[model samples]
Target: MTTTTPAALRAAAERFGDGEAVADGSVRLSWHDLLTAAETVARALIAEGLAPEDRVALCAPNTHHWVAAVLGAQYAGCVAVPVNTRFTEPEMAEILTRSRARALFVVGTFLGVDRLARLQGFLDGVTVIRIPGEGDRPSPDVIEWDALGAVAERVPVEVARARADAVTPDQVSDILFTSGTTGRSKGAMTAHRQALGVAAAWVECGEVTSADRYLIVNPFFHSFGYKAGILAALLSGATMVPQAVFDLDRTLELVERERITVLPGPPTIYQTMLDRPGKRPSTLRLAVTGAAPVPVVLVERMRSELSFQTVLTAYGLTEAVVVTMCRPGDAPETVSRTSGRAVAGFEVRIAGDTREILVRGPNVMLGYLDDPEATAQAVDGDGWLHTGDVGVLDADGYLTITDRLKDMYVCGGFNVYPAEVEQVLARLPGVSECAVVGVPHERLGEVGRAHIILAPGTSLSTEDVLAHCAERLANYKIPRSVEFRTELPRNATGKILKRMLRDG
Candidate 1:
């Protein structure tokens, strides 16, 4: 048996043929139907003469068809590159050029902009395969999402099966680009075995099973959503319900209507649910949340008021899909405070002096695609991937991320990690969310300044926040000033845009 994603999909289909596999609003496909659709698209690629190992870019939102295209690429033995939906025209072109994607699977119109038009200059030598999203109409020079089956019907299905079977563990499965928060993004090439290991790890650590229903709100382009969210469901035989964008009311309705058992998202998702909580899903059994600081109170509420059987928090980067996950029976403090212990088959250690988190395991990427220097800088010569994020591995091996190396600043000879300060603020009364950045200070060279979000109808003065921090935190770690806002800005993945805060 192959360990690739396509192999997993076929196996799941055989076991759960009639069970729902993926749904995007109006369309919900069973495992067998979804697999058959993907295989049809795979054969279409072969009919069009797309060679094995060729690159195929999947640039779309969270749609069932997007899932089909990714599996199809795997069946065709082509490298699937998931492009960021939030990327601008230049960023999109850079990835298309960088990955050298021979074929492009793009959303027709997203956020009122034409994606195909967005890639006009970038399509100089690329084959465009358009997948129309809601409200999109037909145009020339693009293949319709459903038409691929009819076009590929001439090619025998066995040919696509043979191609999928020939895939090796070491071949590139996908090239995921980093968020490029610091600089230009580099494509992290993940092989079949590595990607499989990551997905399998999530299934085991997350305790996901066939009875679970996953509502995937994270964009499919993100590895968290692509590998851990989608592929993990395939591995566990869980039903997938894809949500393209996160609308609180709509999500609540979907959860209740579909009997969603497993829901994973960032802090924002839960915060919104807590604020509104339209209707508690009768089947909400588990919640695996990360990508932001989880206030201790939030975890308590999820397991109690939200009626989640288990609540878990995990930590990982794109280079490593899921490094650690809090276990099912962990205490609320453990789930909220730490990122849990390292997942099976991976080791986590803090650098000797810098305290930078280092990870080594089967899940680490092969390398940054076509960028040896960047690869060397990230993963050292000794095979340990030097994650730039600073963290502390407790005695029990539970890791608590303190801050990014780039985000740390020294104030009056004391180092201050923004996450540490932010956590202290998160516990403050009436605080919904907060961000801390080191601003230039003449006396100390730099001082921590906080931007805080207050809950609706709740008032928190800067004096109250500062006084609360003074009692709980050290002087150097405390923010020198505070600025209140309706909400903090976030990136596509729901991570706070600290750079934007600093720039402002």
Candidate 2:
């Protein structure tokens, strides 16, 4: 429990050796088994000529193999790059080329095989290791993941212990690519110490314990999923329940069946669960929502309707794992309205026009991978990460997010932020999800438009949505037009891609 270094796996192995570590449906592993798997994978990478500091890209879903490969790369002192599993072939190739990965661990499926084939030209000399399954076989040059285990001798326990202890907190742990809305994604290079720092802060603020059972619904590729969900659970000696894909029915059933104590995911997930038929479990202790903004109505429904013990909202980015979080004891209104106060060991401030949120702390990422200029631009010389978010802090210290600086549209001499309008639309009855974007206009330079997805069996017209928006929002902020879709385009992390709406 007194672990101070970045090697979280080592600490977990020593502290909770025989305890349940991870469970993915029928597949389960204890802390001891997890450690052994990681050690074996590490030795395999070393045997395959992978040197320290080399990049290992993991392109797979949230499976047991993905977790093993991540720990293995870290154990071998290599930087792990987790690619978004939902990315297209070209998109995956772009990330691989940018990271300049020495090797890639891919899932064995028709899509995975085809993606690898398309990436062959871009990969050039990079080695590809396929996770054995029903798929096209790779060339002789490519290696099978299972075969690697056969050739890789188990590293000595003493040597593995020593290597893990030698890893400093400042060493680069992973390069997580951000899902950018406007431009190409940037790889945020996070250090071991920084990641652990965020986990430690969460423990201090949220009071996580070893008895807690964390249900990990977020994709491991995202920072929130890795640090807040995985590392936090490991550090606290809690059992991690991973779901490869998010299904509302399965998630609720898991909570009831496993007696899951903690549920952490985006607001959409919580909303979906609320709409389901099952009632909240008596054992459910806390519900944490992050990654995207949550409407106050949803938080109120979770507490008043579902009777959850606690509903907490958080705000963070890949650069900083978690900067702000609403504690359980905080006012329900505060939890619903603001992103809560800054977590321990961090500072949040609004600068310039009082719309730009700035964060500074030890938990901040080192920089973007291979892009010093972009890094310099994001983190100023003063050490403040210019979070592109627009927010306001009340005199009582509650932080209320208004919009994103880049997402604001100038309409008829007034600024119309999409978040404000989207929040209004989200409040409409039968509206499942919505996104607002700026469209080109001849007179006002830009106009607001709303793309919405209604709940099943619910019907609404464009005029009805517009009327609902007009009642809650300003005239300028109201959507000039509305478009209904079966589903909104979302990234791997479930974040709606507003740019796609604009482009379409």
Candidate 3:
């Protein structure tokens, strides 16, 4: 069995060989090519004197280099710390500092910004490897991506391969940082076995195969995009076509051009594709989405108009990816209403009183990196991970996420889950996206406030929103106030920054 990621790469190279592993723009690498590249990266790390389990950070987009760089770190028996590309300098610096990353693989430029230059002050003593990007210039003290081959020549290929073979399943493979919605982001440490376990489980549930081509629109930094997207493709032999940034036109073009068979993203991705100007024929077969409410109407539209045969909704956090996933051939209503039963060998049960979803599983994270107290609070003595989100499991084992525990607000002694309210608001015409947050109220202590992003060229009055909610929801459940915006603030993943909304 391929227990570690490096082992998986070797197995992939042996099995798939020349099969296309990654397709990023003009760059395409076969499985054998990918393995060779990763080995070269491992050799480079070895030459740099990075010890076993030492941290290396990759803060680039979902390009092929991001894929190769991370795999190379694993191949070298190093723990990869994937930094969010959307983070500000301070946030990036914090992660680099906290993770104690000895080397950094960052894009030279992205979206007219020099990401490395921006972090000049914080990158002291960190070995910087610059990946080619738009309008980038040569810099001192930074290793170019192509120059890794030369640095790697110092260490023999046999040495790197031996190091990769020695990596144990129990060793920490990667440290994935949380979105930090509540406070400081916690790095969730996942072992080689656990990471592969989740990917294999996702592969089983999604029915992924070697023939499938996966379009990875999700950011590589997030678990959904990294574990479920890149790693899943690696395990299943699916071709990974990464989209650095989500451009509607570019995504549609790639879907048609690449004959993309599997596309997984948040609900907004499908909705945006559905709302595109004209129908673009696609071969999209499987779509796994979550992170927010997926309306039944959207599911129906995705099947009917978007031509998706199987759409699965899944629920997971950074601690454990692929917790529950709706299986293939499930009814649209089933896919829309619930995130499917536990996969990845997870035992799921709702905590008695709080109704917080607790999971005990092989794929569950070992613990938060360097945060013992937080780790203790999250995982109990019984080995159940106390997922902070509130949810209910149905008779058939379907899991319905109600809301985050912190997002629930009491109105006149009545608890209102923002998800339920948001679901109702999603059905409203002209409502492109909506978020319900509890705001300070003098009498009720807390009242729901709706922040809406209207569909383009569409308009809705405060009364229009209130009247619609009044008809569907109870008086207390209705938002006391409504605010419209061009766009809602979201983190690296599509999850809304509810804390920001609440603060506003």
For every model shown, what is its TM-score relative to the native structure?
0.81, 0.78, 0.83
Q: How much is the lDDT of residue 193 in candidate 2? A: 78
In model 2, state the lDDT of residue 11. Answer: 78
User: Which runs in model 2 stand beyond 4 Å of their true positions?
Assistant: 1-6, 110-114, 132-141, 154-162, 179-182, 304-307, 408-504
Give per-residue CA lDDT, model 3, range 13-74, as digits (tens).
88898999999889999999999999999999999988889999999989999999999999
> What order do candidates take by lDDT, descending?
3, 1, 2
Model 1 over residues 291-340: C-alpha lDDT tens digits? 66677998988877778898899988778888999998999999989999
C-alpha RMSD of each candidate structure in angstroms = 11.0, 10.6, 10.4
Deviation of model 2 at 345, angstroms: 1.1
How much does candidate 2 score in TM-score? 0.78
lDDT of 2 by residue, 1-504 (tens): 333332678778888988888887787888888888888777777767777778999887676777778887788878889887666565688788899898898876643345566566777768777765455666786778777677466445455455566666678888998644334568999888787788877766667777888888777877666777777877888888887777777877888877788777766676766777756666767777754556678788877766567888877877898888888787777887888788847888999765799999888899988789889989999999998889998886668888766676655434466866777687899899988898876544568988989999999999999888765554666788899999888899998888788889
Model 3: residue 158 alpha-carbon error in angstroms = 0.6
How does model 1 score by TM-score? 0.81
Residue 154, candidate 1: Cα error in Å is 3.0
lDDT score for residue 339 of model 3:
94
Candidate with top TM-score is: 3
